[model samples]
Target chain A: MNEYLENAKAQMRKGVLEYCILSVLSEGDAYVSDIIRRLKEAQMIVVEGTLYPLLMRQKNAGWLAYRWEESTQGPPRKYYAITDAGRQLLAELDTAWQDLGDSVIKIRQPEKTHSHEKRI
Target chain B: MKNVFNICINGIIFGIEEDAFKPLSDYLEPLKAYFSREKDGSEIVADIEARIAELFTERPGGAATAITIADVNAIISTLGTPAAIAGVDESANTEAQPCAPRRTARRLFRNPAERYISGVCGGIATWFGMSPAILRIALIVATFFIHWLPILYLVLWAVIPLAKTTAQKLEMYGKEVNITNIEQSVKDNSLDTGSPVQTFFRDVDSALGRFCRILLRIVVLVIGLKLIVAGLMLLVAFIVWTCLQDVLFRDVVKWDFLAYEEMLRHIISASSYQIFMICSVVFILLTVAACLFWGAQLIRPFKTGNRMTHILLAALWAGSAMGIVGISLREMRHFTNPNSMSETFTVPVTDTLHLQTVSANMKLSNNAVTGLYFDKSQQRFFGEPTLNICHSRNGQALLEIRRRALGRSKPDAFDKLAGIGYQVAINDTLLQLPDLFSVSPPDRWSFQEVHLFLYLPENTIVAMDEGVMAHMHSNAHSRTGQQEYLWRVTDKGPRKIK
Candidate 1:
């Protein structure tokens, strides 16, 4: 039962990871390291390695684009930016997130009333 | 000190320790494989490499510091495993997945870790999924039947590269070049969670390895037994040959009356001969002892002696070998200077002159010794002389006797030549020569030899006896082992008169 809960939690995280990457890129043009830092700060991804393939998949679908930039510390970095398609996808995901939040609140309202009655 | 390699990752050069490099690369291999299924797989890998480079640069020592295994493990945890990076639950995969791609093509590389000599056999055993000990034993047995096997082994040693890197080691065993296997190989174990088929093959490989190891142990035991037997036999032979020379080899060899040391005393000087005898005895004893000890140790490994005992035995063997070499070099000075003395006697010219060989009136004994003969009656040693017939430079018939000996100097050689005695008698038309020359005592056997040259005038006829055939050294005539032959001395050489 615990294993199923852990697996379901992972699935839920994975489903929203792409939407989070596009949202992070919508802010500004960022390199892989910068993007990974933002996603990790928000607890959207566990490993930095997981973000590369998601970003690649997004770029392949014309939702994101990247450019090579020289770095002072090491090799050249690939800077990623949200394309017009990516912005459109992010706007649609924002509305969908809002609708899901509203539905959860409405469903909890009845449960809260029943729990309160049981307490009385 | 750990070996350090300079590697370029994502166009950024970094120095990494050998132990660290294996795990680091192992972590990257599966990531590369997993990402390769995507459209921009290479780009993703390159980006990952770039991030790793950045992480390395951000360390305390920066890029100047060599990466350690701890650093690599830290980086791996941060990046996560290939399954984790792919967002797949590692726990679930472990329960369901096979350990690695089964039986990839194995490459030939010398295994440096588990090696006895240069890792050739160890590498071959690993390649074939067997035990190294078995391969080593088979090679040793093969060396006896195929003499050039050592040369081929040397060639292979030079040709095969050592599996120095983790990926190379994985390739050597035909393990898939992936993160999990690399990690497992580095840790020196198989994955705890593998499918039933992978588990079955692993069990079989280990079982075969165990079987080969047992066979190798048995072969070593048998070899130890053989060596003990051989060493004991050699010891007994040496004792019999040295102590009971007269009883064991009396009829076989003429020197059987003299003991081993006594025979040496006849040839070498008194003072040096003693040293030679001591060195030779020590050498023989040490050799036999070493053989026995080695055999015993192989039969029961590390059961008898410690490192100190081995060191002492090695030192004694080396010392005895050096002593033998020194004594031999000292004895070789006697043969440095060789001198010869020749005498010519004019013979009566006749149409036909008879040439004959006279024996010493002693029974010819069939002896195994060569070059030197012992005269029991006179208590002296005699050596055979050579006889040759040639045309005379002048018109006179002449007979020349040349005696040669080796000594310390010219005069010493001439003094030793006085010990060599060869008698020749000219009776009008008949010439008689002694078959052997005597070397009396105080001069020793110093390669003493005599040569008789019978020079005849042109058209002079000479008749040779059958007894002289043994001493004949003439290439002009075809020796058919005939009883007697007549030859006429011509300008060119002696021509057979039939």
Candidate 2:
């Protein structure tokens, strides 16, 4: 039962992880480790394995592109950048996420109906 | 260690242990399988492997000589397990245990508030749920047994973080760092203020502690540097001396139990000499290595094997010493009996009997032989026969030549002494002697010596050539002059001829 809740939470977070990755890449290009570090700093991702497939899928869908950058310390790193399609996708996901957040807040906190009514 | 396999991941090459390579390869297989459905799956796996290689290079030690199974396991932990990478738990992999919930493990943190020598023991005791006093007693006992235990403790004290914050102190003792605990700790600290006297003593104690620590560090640095230099010079000297002995005197020095190698071999076991040499060499090497190790450790602490290593080294050193002593005693047995060989020749008493040396051309063998030179004259080697003029026992004028050697028995020593080849020719008044004594090739060089005793009558005179004066016996009263002086023996001992 606990495992099911964890899987459900993981799935919920997985959806927005893509939106977050696109939003980060929209600003500038980043190495794969740099992206993982940024996501970790925000407490949005758990493992590095989750990012590779997501980045590959985004690239396959023509929303992201990556190039190899040589590193002085060790192996060359894969740097990812957002294509125009990824920016468009990020814009659409931002609006949808804000709407879902507001609806969830309204449903969960019925005592805030007065504030909700005033805002509407 | 087992042989390592050379592997190339991406463009970099690494030598990995045979056992670690299998698990690491197996781990990558699953990663490949997980990404197989994607178009660029192999590329992703390659990139990950390259990253794994990079991380492996950054392990505590610089390069992986033989990557152990532990190294592979550590890499897996850092990169996540195969099951986590695949996101699908396969029942086939028994190692796919779910990652445990990340709980704060009690970290070792020195508590300055309760410190006695960095509070490392206190921190360790708290972490292990033991009383600090018991741990301190145990550590003291271990330090006595293990010579480097104190240094190891100091290194840990330098490395482990201090528990400065309340949360860290709570973690050190495995206490829950919640709001209640924090509030209670704050309240306790505010209420329990030490007396002014206690506070003053504490401040003085910490100040003294800091001063001692700095002083110890400076002393260690200076002494360590000095010892390191001394150790290096000793090592170099040892190397040079050993090399010279091994190379330069390989055939010259008869490495036998006694003087004559062949004779000793026939009399006693030859292996004892070899054992003695080996034992001495091992003892020297172990002592030198210990010195170098200690000096290096003082300069910079390193993780060395525990007490067992020291015990084993000490045992080996003792064993070598015993081996040397046993073999040396065995060798000394060959010299128990002494013997001498003497030849006497009658000579007519003259006013003066001059002692002169034969030319060097006659002394040098057709084949070149190298040995220690006894004087400025390169022609005379240490084993070369020495001529010492002494008074003969009888009142009659005569010359006696005695050669000496040692052996296990009387006859053996006499036979060995007889092998010394020394010759003197009487030409008119001049006694011509070979510049160097020759020991037969078959005879071993036992401290063999040649003594030439020329007996003089009460009124007879004697003179020595400058060439043989260097080999004169201490009692021979030969006066030194620009031209060698002759000495006349009257009733009142020998007097210089004016």
Candidate 3:
């Protein structure tokens, strides 16, 4: 029973990985390690392997561009930056997420209509 | 001691223990399999590899060190299995439909734990739900008829990644890679649940592997040592030859160059031959040393100045080859338009003629004695003309002395050929000839040598000393005896005189 639930949770997390990556990159160009740190801070991504495929797909689709930057330690790192296409897609996703959040809030807390909770 | 394998990941070099490399490879293989059908699969894999390399860098003093199983396992857990990530693609492919939970595909991994000789047959047997013994028997039988089967098996063993983890062991048997299967496989393998025959074969396999490794190491060491010794000898010989080329070829080495002293002088003056010799020797020595070093590296691989040395040696070799070819082309000009000059002398029609060599103690200069010594050494480097006995055209005994040489043109060849000095003294019935012919320096070697033809009339009898046999052509069947013997010319040919 626990296995099924854990599997479901992982599946749910996999769906949102691409959106989260795009969102992280939307703020500014970031090194892969920096992006990984941001994702870990949000507790949205676990293994770094899972995000690689998503980042590669985004880059291949011309939604992202990357450049090599010299690192203080070790070799140079590849920094990925969001392209215009990526920003356009992020805007659409943001609108859809807002609508979905509103609908879910209305359905779950019908009694407290129009009430907003401050969450961290 | 644990052996470490050097690997390049994302263009960065890393050393990892042999035991840990298997599990790490196993962890990466599934990720590759998951993205294989994707449009940007290889790029995704490359990114993943880079990320792994980055993670290794973050490890405590682990940047260039050997990565252990613990490190690999931690990374694998953090990355999550490919099965965990399959949902997104599956859901997208199904067109917004609820994604069905898919069973993880079973992977064929070589079972090293129970392996006898690479464990390929064992892993395959487990995959097919068959006994490993049966597969081993079948393979052995097939190997007898199909000569290449053993080689193919070795190639497969090398290519297939071994199943080191419980998850991998479960996958090897086509079992689900869930927790229960992993737990069961671990328990089953740890506890001796396998048959006695399997255990025996496993032990034998491991023992054989150790033996093979030791044997291979000895073979490589012996071959490496031999190469080093051979290379050192070649280098020493080259040094000695270079230092003593002139002395060795001139005095110590009694080589008769047909006594063309002028030709020898010309050859020595030309610097190209010397350059050709030195360059060739250097090239050969360096190549030998390179081969020895390569053998040593093969025996025990380690980082060295491999590329720079290779380039340097290759360039030197090429330069030497060009020098040899260019110098040889120039040398070839000295050997054209071969010509011969003949001088005929009349002799009295004696009933019996005796041909003999001058005594070793006869009146001769010091140079002549050394020339005789060189001839006696049997190290003649130039061609000597044949002495022929033929019937005279004018029914008289005539001695024809001919000297042959090669030069740039007809006049030059004739002049060089005429320069060859030889003397023949006729005393009564005896004709005496010098054993060693002389040639002076300032002239390049021109294959100069004299040919003596004793033109005897129909009834004239001839006797030749044993020394004359050295100059006689092989086809001239001169009847030779313990002492000088006479031969009478008959209708058939020269017949031994009673």
Q: Top model by DockQ, which number?
A: 1
User: How many Å off is the CA of B476 in candidate 1?
Assistant: 16
**What are the per-residue Cα lDDT tens digits for candidate 3 across B1-498?**
799998888777888989999888766665554455467776777777887888887789867678888888887787665544443445454444344434565577787655657889877776666667677768878989999998999898988888765556656656554433333344345312433356666665556667767988898888888777787887777665556555565666444323323233245345765686677777787677776786778668878877887788789888987877777677768777899878898788888888887544423212332232233243222233457777665777888988887877889888777666567898877888766554432134566777888788877887778777666654555544567766776555466667
Tell me the deviation in Å of residue B287 in model 2.
2.7
Using Cα atoms, each model's DockQ against the true complex is 0.40, 0.17, 0.34
The list of candidate 1 runs beyond 4 A from truth reads A1-120, B1-161, B164-222, B251-261, B296-302, B351-368, B374-381, B390-396, B409-415, B439-441, B457-498
DockQ of 2: 0.17
TM-score of each: 0.49, 0.38, 0.50
Choose the strongest candidate by lDDT.
1
* lDDT at A44, model 3: 82
DockQ-superior candidate, 1 or 2: 1
Better by TM-score, candidate 2 or 1:
1
lDDT of 1 by residue, B387-433 (tens): 88888877888899999999988888888898788889999999998
- Model 3: per-residue Cα lDDT over A1-120, one tens digit each: 998897678777776777788899989999988898999999887766667767777788888899988878666778999999989988998898899889998999976773444321
* DockQ score of the complex predicted as candidate 3: 0.34
lDDT of 2 by residue, B269-367 (tens): 557756766787788788777777877888899999899989999999999999978876877777777888789987776777887877555322221
lDDT, each prediction = 0.77, 0.68, 0.69
